[model samples]
Target: MGINLQKGQKISLDKEAGGGLSHIVMGVGWDAATGKTGMLGGLFGGGGGNIDLDASCLMFDEQGNQTDAVWFRQLRSRDGSIQHTGDNLTGEGEGDDEQIKVDLSAVPANVKSLVFTVNNYTGQDFSKVANAFCRIVNGANDSEIARYDLSCQGSHNAMVMAKLYRHNNEWKMHAIGETGKGRTFEELLPQIKPHL
Candidate 1:
């Protein structure tokens, strides 16, 4: 269901040319009716509401299944690779802001590329989502790469599937779709996948 990124390992946008490292900006957005859509206030969230009670909930137990809300994914040119990850949940502000750090040195041998993703965790109420968009760039030098846009807007929070890019290119910013419901990872998954 997700990819886990540790300390080391990665791939380049261009293997022969050497995939320059950058910041991939994955952003997700949606109109929400959640009150106290920030930290602390969500502590009161329970069954009556769907907001998470914790502000630092990168992962949570959804319907008895333990899933990580935050993660990092990589694609290897040799063995199978993970192109996306889970950003968990953060009911802090307007968007469900989550980030995964990237280092050129972190690219593992044979790795080709990567995709940063956010997990959705909305209950059985969101079914009106439309799209998920992603932007790539070298966060340090601020170089941008190709972008992937989809019509995936939904009724609840969503898991930013991922902003994919080649490793040999100048990598950078990533934008994951955030349509509300950041209190928990499970409640935010719907914003990314409309059919999920």
Candidate 2:
């Protein structure tokens, strides 16, 4: 089993993967909350609808400038080191609704950090979502390294899920459960700057 990461927790990817960590998979999953009873329930018409959540990766330089991005629109990074598997419109899956693959060795040295984010493309707030989680897996053996459950429920439509950054020449994972209002990665850029 992998570590169940809490908000603000950090783990070394190199140490976790036992040193041969060339590639990793970041998976995000969620399901629509059901049977919500309140004003929100009425607004969502009893609360059982497809939630279109988009998973995205924003690459930043050592100076915190955005160098590249990979999301539903652009499935691959400019340098081809990162690739978003695809978009999941309904949020109706047993496993990961979306997955982003990162080639640690292939990532340009200039790229210092990769921020993973998820937004409700359907414009529904997180109160309408449930069981949301982001996990890191070893692409070599398919073993989970760590997972962060997105348990914050609120009016926000987006979340800066987690970050993979370079520290001491090694990559590390940080669980950042910050919430905000945004329908896409661009809208969340400002909120993400402070964390980087």
Candidate 3:
């Protein structure tokens, strides 16, 4: 089982995995909040409709400048170190709805951090999203290392979910469940700076 992380919590990937990790998969999942009790039903005049949430990875240098991004519009980063699987239109079935793959060793030397984010591209606030979560999986063995729940109900449409950063040549995961308003990752750049 993987550790359940709270907002602002940080964990060393090396220690959690028992050693260094070469490849990792960051998975994001969610389900549309159902019933009239849900925010969507109360606020948006609807209930149990599809929510299109997008998962993205933003790479940054030591200076906190965005170096590259891998998102729905751009499936792969410039250096090819990160790749987004695809976009999931409906917050539907089972496990992860979307995933981003990262090659830690292949990441450019200048890149110091990788920030993960989720945005409601369809503009539905998180109150309508249920069971939202982001998890880190050891790509080699398909074992989850850690997970952060993002099911907090709110009016915000985007969340700076978590980040993976280089520390002493090792990578660490930090949970930052900062909610904000944005339809895309680019709009959340300012909100992501302080955390880096």
Candidate 4:
């Protein structure tokens, strides 16, 4: 929906053309410096991880103002997304949960809307307390495309933004909810350039 792809431009999942790419997520909001600060599944080596819950996500438009258009969605499982809870933050979980999918039939039928974020995380000592989010389960029955929230302040690094599409017609989610005091992601790129 929020069209803008150039950082690698390769959008063909070619699974026989029903659609191509479909999964890629990167949420960074909770850092104490580097090493473990809190929660992330069983710990060390058990074969399953990711669960740094702090909770916070919002989207209101009957009167609430704080819009930031433009979007990003690299979710798969046929848009119902069902994998990669990797959660690495500063421990490096392979390209940080490499989420880069969008094969809604190659997404060029005049896309609609898509954007999300919660960019913050630095861990090593303390300062903790962060919130994160991710959801895109529509059609095939998973139906969820709206769990946006990016709480604000307490910077260790911030860039929490959100926006999803298909208003009145169907799907919806417009979030600027919070988080972007500018710290890393390159000073949150001028607060994400007015949501581009």
The lDDT of each candidate is 0.35, 0.92, 0.92, 0.33
List model 2 lDDT by residue over 36-145, tens digit each.
76777678676556899999999999999999999999999999999999999998869899999999999999999999999999898999899999999999999999
> How would you encode candidate 1's per-residue C-alpha lDDT over 10-122 as one tens digit per residue?
32333312354333333333332344234554565422243221211122122322233334232221222212334333334553234343444544443333433433444
Record all residue pairs in model 2 with backbone atoms less than 3 Å apart, i.e. clashing.
none
The alpha-carbon deviation from the true structure for residue 56 of candidate 4, after best TM-score superposition, in angstroms, is 6.5
Model 1 residue 124 lDDT score: 22
Models, CA RMSD each: 11.7, 2.0, 2.2, 12.4
Q: How much is the lDDT of residue 61 in candidate 3?
A: 96
Model 2 misplaced stretches (Cα beyond 4 Å): 37-47
Q: How many pairs of residues in model 1 come into backbone collision?
A: 75
lDDT of 3 by residue, 43-116 (tens): 76564567999999999999999999999999999989899999999968899999999999999999999999
Estimated TM-score for each candidate: 0.38, 0.94, 0.94, 0.29
Question: What's model 3's TM-score?
Answer: 0.94
Q: Per-residue lDDT for 51-82 in model 4, tens only?
A: 23221222223323322222222123333322
- lDDT score of residue 148 within candidate 3: 93
lDDT score, candidate 2, position 81: 97
